[model samples]
Target: MLALGIEGSANKIGVGIVRLDGSILANPRHTYITPPGQGFLPRETAIHHQQHILPIVQAALKEAGVTPDQIDCLCYTRGPGMGAPLQAGAVVVRILSLLWKKPIVAVNHCVAHIEMGRVVTGAVDPVVLYVSGGNTQVIAYSEGKYRIFGETIDIAVGNCLDRFARVLKISNDPSPGYNIEQIAKKGNKFIELPYVVKGMDVSFSGILSFIEAVAVQQLETNEFTDADLCFSLQETVFAMLVEITERAMAHCDKKDVLVVGGVGCNIRLQDMMRIMCSERGGNLYATDDRYCVDNGAMIAYTGLLAFANGVTTPLEEATFTQRFRTDDVHAVWREKKSLPLKENGVVNPGIN
Candidate 1:
């Protein structure tokens, strides 16, 4: 079966086509490179989506050597993203589904991240650590659903990083997150910062404030380098995430851990998580920018599974949700035992 997926969640506009057998026929990706001077203004983002999304979608379909009529299923990110951008994707997918007489599946953005990690890692029951610009959480598969074990009480990890970058006048030209990652590598000294972890939940607003205060103080003294501060900030935040993820694995008795979402692409964060998981006799799985960052391929891959299991959204049910959760989705695999976990937290090869 051929499926088309569209993702216009935040700043990126990704379109892709995939077959039922988990093969990507064509994946055309694009993002609005917001100028560093303007930052991420929602109105400007919406305007950019309107101007660029369609062409990218058309290009993907053309590259896949498939006409719109050949698609059997239509899928798109349903929410947990900017409303304007989400609506832009939903309207296009909805119209295309109607015109082609194909079934439409509204996939949760976070669940897509989880599914993509599973696809990339081949992990049956890994503890999921999803970190992105708009979200940060620890999740696990339980009782036929992906459940949220713990999450951020306030702002997301990547959002905190972006805000911190802005305060330091760091460039957002290529990508705000990429710029911060580069600056952080040059940092040499570790600065003491607030490390707050209330049980499994985390808070970054306080940390951001503390960093901003330090930045201001350093400007007055003219004694601090932005690189050092960036490094310290990344170290503090990533340490918190690793702590929580390790805690969740211990609590859930899971030995395999999967890291998803945009922030999962950060080399430093992934390296830290990998080391922690290894120390506990656990395996860590992470995605590269292709699947780790926001994209339509994940949505389409997830939607194909959902459709095969008789899951489809009615045309009248078309609507965008701003706060969809990964745990809200029901498992769509063919067999329950396919995701069996051994007592030692390893997948049972005999089960599937």
Candidate 2:
């Protein structure tokens, strides 16, 4: 079946078309760029989506060379995002559903990230480390739900980075995180920062506070370059993420670690996790910006999975929420037992 997905969960507005076999026909996106020392506001971002949704959807359909009637289903991110942006996509999705007479499926934003990671990388039953602006979670499947094994008790890792970038007046064009990564490559000095990990949960608010203070002090005294602050922040935060993911791996007895969400696109974080997995005799799976960051492809793919398995969101009950949890939706597609995975010198011998 062919599915068309609309994603405006955050500042980025994207449209994706996908097939049932996990082939992406078209994935296009436009991000709302804020000035330096600024963050995206929901109102402005939603307006951006409203202005661009029509063109984005048209571009996606044209690029895929498929008519609206050819689309088997319409998929959109329902929640766990900014309310206005979700509504922006929802309004368009409702209009498309009415015009084309296609079924609508609501998808969890976080679940979309996980499903995208699984499909793109073929990482079957891998422990998921979902880190983004609004969320940071370590997930494993259990009882028809993606259970949160660990998460941030305070601010999410990406939020911390973005806020810190604002303090340093970094560019948010591509992304604040990407700018930090670029600056970090030039850094040679590493400043000590607070590292907090309690059991499976990690905390970044305290770390951010300390880093912000250090940046302020250095700015006044000219003691360190901005690269030093960026380097220190990335090392400290990525290390905490790796530590928690490792704990989840040990607890679940899984050898594969699949990283998802926007922050998963970070090369430094991937490198840190890769080293940990290599030392522990496991594998680390991650994706590039296209799949890692929020996109319509993942949303479409996940919605198709559910729609084929007898799931639909009627217009009356179609609504969006800002606080939707990953475990809220019951996945009828994923099986309870683990799917076959390639053995990387861990517990599994071969595909059963």
Candidate 3:
């Protein structure tokens, strides 16, 4: 079966086509970039999606070398994202569903990330660390859903990084987080920042505020460079994440760790996680920017999994939500023995 998915939960708008065999036929995306030191608002972001969603969908189909008649299902991100942006994608998806006469699947955004990470990295039954602009969560599968073992008490780690980049007036051309990662490589000095980790949850508001203040005051004095601040921020926040993730792994008795979401692309964060996983005598699973950041392929792939398991969203229920939790969906497709095959370090998710 073939599926096409749309993603517009935030600043990005993407369309992707995937086969039931876990092959990503085509994935095309566009981002609405704002000026340096500015963040994307929901209205403007939604407008961006409205303007580009059609062309992007066409591009995805063209790249995949397929027609709508060949697609078996339509998929889209239903929630856990900005309201306006989510609605924008949802509307287009509904129209396409009608036009193509295909069934619709509404996928949770966070679950899509986890599913994509699992297929791409071939990490079976691993503790997942999901960190992005709007979410920070430590999740494990239990019962019939992805259980949230821990999460952010305040803002997400990526949000903190983005806001910090705004404070330093860094470029958001590609992404603020990516820019921060690049500059952080030049940092040698580590400035102290607030580390707030309460039990399994983390709080980044205090850290962001403290760092923003420090940047405003100390940056002018040349006492600390932007790179140093970026490095320090990365180190502190990542350490907190590592601590929580390790604790969750020990509690759950899991040996593998999978990192997903936009913030998971940070090299420093991955290095930190790798170190922790090594210390625990386990392995770390992570994807590059393609799967790490939000995209349409993940949605399509996860939705296909649900569709194959006799799941479909009725037209009346084909709507968007802003605050859907990860654990709310019943993951009917997962079997206890479902595992991807890996050959020569390449994962074959279709083998399941």
lDDT of each: 0.83, 0.89, 0.90
Ranking of candidates on TM-score, top first: 3, 2, 1
Evaluation by TM-score, superior candidate among 2 and 3: 3
Task: Please say which candidate is ahead in TM-score: 1 or 2.
Answer: 2
Clashes of each: 0, 0, 0
Best by TM-score: 3
lDDT of 2 by residue, 270-331 (tens): 98998898898988888888788899988998998899888999986677889999999898
lDDT of 1 by residue, 51-88 (tens): 88889888988788789888889999998899888888
- True-vs-predicted CA distance for residue 58, candidate 2, Å: 0.5
- Where does model 1 exceed 4 Å of error? 334-352
Model 3 reaches what TM-score against the true structure? 0.96
Give stretches of model 3 more than 4 Å off.
336-352
Better of 2 and 3 by lDDT: 3
> TM per model?
0.93, 0.95, 0.96
Q: Write the per-residue lDDT of candidate 3 for residues 232-345, one digit (tens) a residue.
A: 999999999999999999999998899999999888899999999999999999988888888999999899899988899998799998999999999998863444423233
